[model samples]
Target: MATFQIEGGHQLKGEIRPQGAKNEALQILCAVLMTDEKVYIDNIPNIRDVNKLIEILSNLGVKIQKLGQGSFSFKSDALYLDYLESEKFKEEGSSLRGSIMIVGALLGRFGKGYIPRPGGDKIGRRRLDTHFGGFIKLGAKFRYNKEERFYGVEAPNGLKGVDMLLEEASVTGTANILMAAVLAKGKTSIYNAACEPYIQQLCKMLNSMGAKIKGIGSNLLHIEGVEKLSGCKHTVLPDMIEIGSWIGLAAMTKSELTIKDVSWKDLGIIPETFRKLGITVEKVGDDIHIPEHKSGYEVTSFIDGSIMNISDAPWPGFTPDLLSIILVVATQARGSVLIHQKMFESRLFFVDKLIDMGAKIILCDPHRATVIGHDFESQLKATTMSSPDIRAGISLLIAALSAKGVSTIHNIEQIDRGYEDIDGRLRAIGAKITRFD
Candidate 1:
């Protein structure tokens, strides 16, 4: 295990470029299995989950080459479908939830797929029922063994597309079914689909590869099955989540930082959500500049002409993944704000740590909290703590960096699962952080 030691109260200042989207790069890599020709993908973030998926793909006989920094070219010449049953496959498959995507790609290309139960942040009960339900609608039969914790699927007669309305707006579920539907025999209409930027990017990539897809940014998607697809070059959009993380860092530390290559158009309600907490971000020619300010920023009211209550929802709304960081920033703001994390039950559990550090917060319930900014300037006593999830890990890191004393963060691997060289990048901007085993 690894830990991060931080000597706090340093202003981070520099121009830091955001990495490629981790969520998008994972599915894009899996999409290569849908085609037989070579594909070149640029701006692939070098992170643990991405590297793990690359190894999994290579084991399935996909030829992968590192072209340069955050670039790769992959070709799936001969895919071994049965390799999913190997020990290496099972080990890698159980490591992350993204591995479940291989199920859809394998079944689309080879008519058979197998995967063990996937693992990821223990936020709540993230069901795979939507994914399997979508696969079944595409003419596939599934069998699972609870004792062995493995799932297998086969479609010998080829997939036949049909209309599907997902029970919930699941992002990965939408991507999985969209990839499978592209090669089916007929048109597939998916309603109540997740239309996040990652899903939209996947649709765009598939369209470029000869797949006919409509409704790129809406809740409804219509995919026309294709006989075959060829390789094409595509560049991933900048990671909005990473950009949001940096924004939170800048606000919490009261520092001036400029984030370049930000896809401001794709930000949707992100900038608005942060603006409510009194964080002023300026957009300058595709770049977001966060200027230095005092700690006690004011909270803005809602559009209905009332006090604002921020929450998460599907696309075109605030993302649940960012609410954790938002809460950290809210602690230093001037007014009270309500945070409702409707997607996950346990995400608000970390606020206890923030409260212990002298912030005035009230946990309304498992799904909501009311935070009254304490503006505590007294030195925060450093303590040992373990990271719980990717977003929460980064949130804790931001809190630790802004605290007044030394703090040791354990299980930094959770943080590394998303952010790339976070300590190094933060250190380059005058942050006092060190990583050690």
Candidate 2:
């Protein structure tokens, strides 16, 4: 278990470039299996989860080559189908939540797919019903092995497109179904689909590779079945979650940091969400400049003078992933704010750690938290803690950076699963963080 020993109470000042979108990278990496031609991808982040997926693809006989830094070429002309049934594959596939995506591509191209119960952040109940349900709708026979916790889908005669309405606008679910639909026999119409930027990127990338997909940035997606897909070059967007994290880190630690090439147009409601917490978010040539909040930030009240409430919704609304950072930033703000995490039940449980550090916080329940800011009149006392999930881990690291003394965070592998070389990146920005392996 790796740990991070952070010497707190220091201001960071420098420019940091956000890495490629992790969520998008997962979908894009899986899409390579849909084509036999060479598909070149750029701006892929070297994080643990993404690397694990790439390793799985390589083990499945996909010819992968590193063209350059954060770039790769993949050719899936042949695949080891038998490997999908192997114990080694079950162990590898179950360990990564993103591995479920590969099943869609494999099913679309090879007529069959199998995956173990996938694992990821222990934030809440992340069900795979949406993924499997979408597959069944596309003419695939679904079976589950409760003893082994395994899922299998097979369409021996190839998939046929169908019009279906998704129960939830799940990003991964939509991507999986969309990938399968592109190769189906008829037109597929998806209603109430997730319209996140990552989904749009996947749609556009698929279109570029001979797929007839319409409604790039909307809820309804129409896909015209194509006989074959050809490979094409694609570049991933910068991670909006990481950009949001940097914004929170700047406000909490009173640092003046500039986040470079943030794709400001794609960052809907993120900068504005931070602004609601009284942080200055300036647009400097496609970059986000977060000024130091030496005088402390204030939470903006509602028009009716009610208590400020920050909640997560689907895209075009605030993202749930950043709500943890928002909760941490609200600790030193001028007023109180209620953080309602509608998507997950266990994310708010990490507030107890912040309360231990002298912050005024009320764990309203498993889904909500009420934070009463100390207004910088009281600084959080450093303490040793353990990371719970990727978002919570980064949120705790932000708290540690702003606390009074040295703080130790155990199980930093949770943090590394998402962020790429986070300690090295923070160090470049004048942060006093040391890592112990």
Candidate 3:
């Protein structure tokens, strides 16, 4: 129940490195379960969800060693199969949605995977149909109990790969199915699969571990089952969502900041998407630089002079995870933009908090918000608020950093589930933010 008390109006200027990707870390940690040898992973983000996943792995008897800060070596040779059915596992694993990936990894290794209905933010209905459906398509028996709300998949006769098309390009679903298919009996072709950098990185990591997977950055992936996979070292890319957040924060608060080691090649349409919101994001080698804005940036209108619409879609489209930050930054821009958060229904509701802070915004619906820029003419006034989820939480923090007076935010535990040491990092760059009991 810790809270953040932020003294607004500080001009941040310094270099800050984004943490390892949280989304990728989740899949990579689960991928370790596919091999029995020691898997060494570097640049792992020290965050809550990752720690919880590691705890679950430790409880399952996966030998884990902390090599150093943000580095770990994992060996699954000593896994206790019986622990999958333990009440302790169900209680802990269900706390985060990433734990669902463990099921697919277990199915790939031992022909069985079980988990209670997984837990995560109440942003919307994040269905598991895609995951279980993918498993069933690959010769696994999928069962769900209505009373207990448990999901279980088993392939006692061993899994045989089958061509499958996902209902949607669900990222976690793609990872789960890809993991399951890697050790199955035949070639598996997945069309309309998610090709986000996280998923592509998983393919590369799996291939390094001796799994045969083609299509590194495309919607179609082909996996040829191998007898087994071996361990390998993996270094995670920087957190793109965090990089986007820092961009928004720099623009909103008139700060100059440099985000280091972003792996720009993997950031598809992210930097350009921020530039569309009137922020100046420059590519300096592998880093992203945002210069302080004396004259606030203005949103660019379409060629037809109509109101700009920023909507999210699958890979190559603007990321839904960043729509919240864009909406917050648009509040201070010189022009208006309609933020269409198509992926998650309840994400735009956080605009109410911004409106309270003296921003002009309209919650058009659950899925869309229209923000009219104040351009610092009407500066935001600080207020008390609670963080809803990871993206929205960071958005609120960005708003607070740009407001007048002080702002106190609660439920930062939701923020910590994603970002790594956000307050400490902000403090290093001259943000007056502190954590308290």
Candidate 4:
């Protein structure tokens, strides 16, 4: 395990280029299993989850080559799907939720797939019912062996597309079905699907590879099955979640940080949501500059002309993954704001740690909380803490970095699973942070 030791109250000032989208890269990497042609991917983030996924692919006989920084070429000319029964396969596949998508891609290409129970942040009960439901709708038969904790799926007559509406707008579920549908027979109409930026990027990349997909950015998608797909080069988009993390880090540390090459158009309601917390983000031609001044910061209201309660939804709304960071930033702002994390029940449990650090916050419920900025200047005593999830881990890091004294954060592997060289990036901006093994 690794820990981050931070000397707090240092203003971070510099420009940082955000990494590629982790979610998008994982989906695209799995999509490579659908074809044996060479696929080149650029701007892939160097994170633990991605490396683990690559290892899984290599074990399956997929040849991967690292050409340069953030660039790689992958070819699956001789993939072996039977490796799913190996202990190495189960161990690596169970480490991240994204591994579940491998089932769809493998089944699409090889007509059979097997995987163990996937693992990820224990935020709440993240059900795989939607994913398997979508697979079943595509003419795949699924069976689970609880004693071995493994699930298998087979498509004998090949996947036949059908019209179906997802019970929940699950992101991975939509991606799984879309990948399977791309190589299926007949047209697939997916209504009430998740159309997040990652899904849209997946659709675009598949289209570039000869897949016919309509309604790229909407919930309703029409995928026409293609007989075959060839290799193509695609660059992953900059991570919007990471951009949100940087915004929170800049505001909490009271720093003048400039984020470059950000996809500002993809930031649907992020700027407006941050403005509510009294943070003014300036757009300078593909760059977002956060000035280092904190005198007149106040929470802005909603479009209905009332005090807004920020919450998470499926898409085109504030992301559930970023709500923790937003809550942390609210502690240093000028006014009160309500954070409603409707997607997860235990995400707000970290507010107790913030409360111990002299932050004025009230935990309204498991799903909602009201934070009143105390602006407390006292030194936050050094304490030992464990990370809960990816976003919460980074949120705690931001709080520890902005505190008055040194704080030790344990289980930094959770943070590393997402952010690439986080300490190095923060150090470049004058953040007094160190990592210890």
Q: What are the Cα lDDT values of the candidates? A: 0.89, 0.95, 0.92, 0.88
Compared with the true structure, what per-residue lDDT tens digits does model 3 show for residues 18-50? 999999999999999998899999999999999
Least accurate 10 contiguous residues by lDDT in model 3: 142-151
The TM-scores of all predictions, comma-separated, are 0.98, 0.99, 0.99, 0.97
Give the candidate order by descending lDDT: 2, 3, 1, 4
**Candidate 2 — which pairs collide?**
none
Worst 10 residues of 1 by lDDT: 374-383
**Which wins on lDDT, candidate 2 or candidate 4?**
2
lDDT of 1 by residue, 350-428 (tens): 8888777666779999999998875645544566788988999999899898887888889999999999999999998
The digit string of per-residue lDDT tens for model 4 on 15-125 reads: 999999999999999999988899999999999998889889999999999999999999998987678888888888888788999888877777778888999888888
